[model samples]
Target: MATYNLNDIVLGVDIGGSHITAAIINLKEKKEIKSTWNRNLINAKGTSHQILQGWASTILQSMESVETKPEKIRIAMPGPMDYETGICLIQDQDKFRSLYSLNIKELLAAEIGYDPADISFHNDAACFLKGELYGGSLYGFDKAIGLTLGTGLGTSYTSSGKAEDADLWNMGFLEGIAEDYISTRWFVKRFYELTGKQVADVKELIDNHAGSTDFYQVFSEFSNNLASFIYQFIQRETPLAAVIGGNIAHADTYFMKETQQELNELLGYSFPVKKSFLGESAILLGAGAST
Candidate 1:
């Protein structure tokens, strides 16, 4: 077994709709121990035992990759979860329905043989921003906003070293809510409406339709919609900068420039917007730092 400085080591986990990713992070170094990173695909609709076990298994895999046991385990999880009490309140989200109202911290601690106090949960969006604020793109900013664009949209705000969920996903927008027009579902739905074709997600759309006229049109509309939403966000928070992450952000070439330009036109000035420098690692680093 290799010797490690255990005091600085922590297990950081990010639980998404279809997968769980975990790694050992060195808080003193503000980075993940890359060799210990582990990810596992999970069925969100599975029974509670299956989901919890899958998560626990992946976490254990990461923890066991190194000789030292981490000081604590921190998780970046999607909400309507009670972060303080560790109960999941998610329902009607088409994912994790089996976990509704379950106490994840206690259940996961039992699976991993840790005291419940050793485990903690936080909003994934806030964690993402916190990661950026700590050592990524938003590092130097005193106030910033973060957007995670994937299966769903996540928003967070930070100021004076504190980060919290902005909870803007359900905010009212054009026809329904902000997420209805800003997330992966919007890309899939809009692409189908324009071309009568199906795409599993943004990557599929980009892979199958890159450079096509319909592709340009779809992203153009997306740029406008994103700009409109950011306009509202800025009006409310007045953040010094904004950082974006998640799977869909990988295609920033398609929409970022136009979105920035549109937002500038709306606000009558250049606002700082940046792509996430740490990618998925931001969640892990953020979760670990919170510990």
Candidate 2:
């Protein structure tokens, strides 16, 4: 075996509608020893620059506290974003519309004194799959896909360790788009309106349902639709497996079972739905991998 010495560290950040998470990753050891800093993303917050500055503050503070100097910044953002230009175009479709034109990579580098060469960006969904493909739960699935069910639905498709495809988030779901119909935001809002009970979000529903038949039924319906979409994708461009890594994946096993059943019915062949192995650290590890 060839001996390898240490290399510079990387700072990874994932910006979701619900939260902004940051972590530090050591490239040599292949471990994200530092815990991440996550803060709730207020829909009513200031402009994208301001919001991003807030996120950067959290990340920088965390690094300082740990006495670590990460040499590169790797960020995973929502889709319809132009990774080549650092332009975000899915604003109207995203929960955060005001952040449409924010040049995140450039801004972060300027604010933190990091050179342009020290930063990069990718679709959050794609990076999620990269995380799985590299070392996450679906590590061995050379052909696979990953989904993150958050404020809005996100997906990343991959084959042979490269992520370059899209799926059921914007193109085909409900009447028009997946985010409008099947997001956790919709799941919680509709549930509260129908049952007069507030669910914190997907995580709460998965954790404390206590077999609320009505909620389970609604969730089951959503799962079926999601799985059906996945099955259709599999038919068009087949893959060996699928991995789930969103907050929703950890909840009541029944939801996954419902989804699996739908996939089984429409899937041309058999496969497995593995739970996420990396959790939040995936973005940083994946971001570093991108570099």
Candidate 3:
């Protein structure tokens, strides 16, 4: 079995819309201890106690897996949240609504028998970019954008090694907002509109309808919409590059190349749009590095 020095390790946790993932990370090595990683499904609509206990249990499992206590725990959470104070202000987002206005750090610390000072929170989108900037695809870039394409669109911008949420999910695009056109819901909605059938997500659409013209049509439209969004984002941020992550990015083969082509045409120059190199580990590494 692998052994770790407590001083060299920290616990990194990522709370998503429907799950929580925890892992021990070796800060010096900038990598996750895969053996210590734990993920558990969570009911976002549950009571605060249920949600908190679920998170605590998963974190404790990770610690037990590693057989050692970590020096600290850092969480990557969705917002509107007060990262500095570790308070959750999320509301009307259809997730974590039960946690509104709660002191997450104190509650989590109490559940896990740790000092409140030992726990910290960060915006999930920023964490994704910070992870890339730390040791993944965006390593050498001083300025870049990160987009997480999944249940909801997550956006972040990084400059000089610091990342902040871009909060562009609701930004106006086409007739609605950027997310309305670029997110997983768009694919489901579009496919259903075309065929009067329902798909759970992008993967199912691709897997089951790979040969359907409607499948290719949906991707083509999505690619153009994504490129248009990126063009505007680049104009505002002028990032050196952009890294795409999240569950939907797994379908990059269908949209990435076309998105790049459309973006180049729109900009009259080539721009870098790379796939996430770190995958889910990016959040764990980012949380650990922040600590």
Score each candidate by Cα lDDT: 0.91, 0.71, 0.89
Which clashing pairs does model 3 show? none
Clashes of each: 0, 0, 0
lDDT of 1 by residue, 24-105 (tens): 9888888998888998888888999999999999998887767788868999998889998899998967689999989988
For 1-291, candidate 2 gives per-residue lDDT tens digits of 112232656777777776777767667777665544544455523677677677677667656645547676788877777787777676566455666776766776777778867778877888888887888788766888777776777777875559753756776666777666567777787777778888877777766775788777778777787787777667765777887776666663757887887778776556787777887777657776675
**lDDT over C-alpha atoms for residue 288 of model 2:** 66
Off by over 4 Å in 3: 1-3
Candidates in order, TM-scores: namely: 0.96, 0.87, 0.93
Give lDDT for model 1: 0.91
Q: Could you tell me the lDDT of residue 103 within candidate 1?
A: 92
Segments of candidate 1 deviating more than 4 angstroms: none
lDDT of 3 by residue, 138-186 (tens): 8999999999887778899976568989989889999998878878889
- Which wins on TM-score, candidate 1 or candidate 2? 1
Give candidate 1's total backbone clashes. 0
Clashing pairs in 2: none
After superposition on all C-alphas, the RMSD of every candidate to the true structure, in Å, is 1.3, 3.6, 1.8
Once fitted onto the true fold, the runs of candidate 2 whose alpha carbons sit more than 4 angstroms away are 1-6, 35-45, 66-68, 165-167, 196-200, 204-209
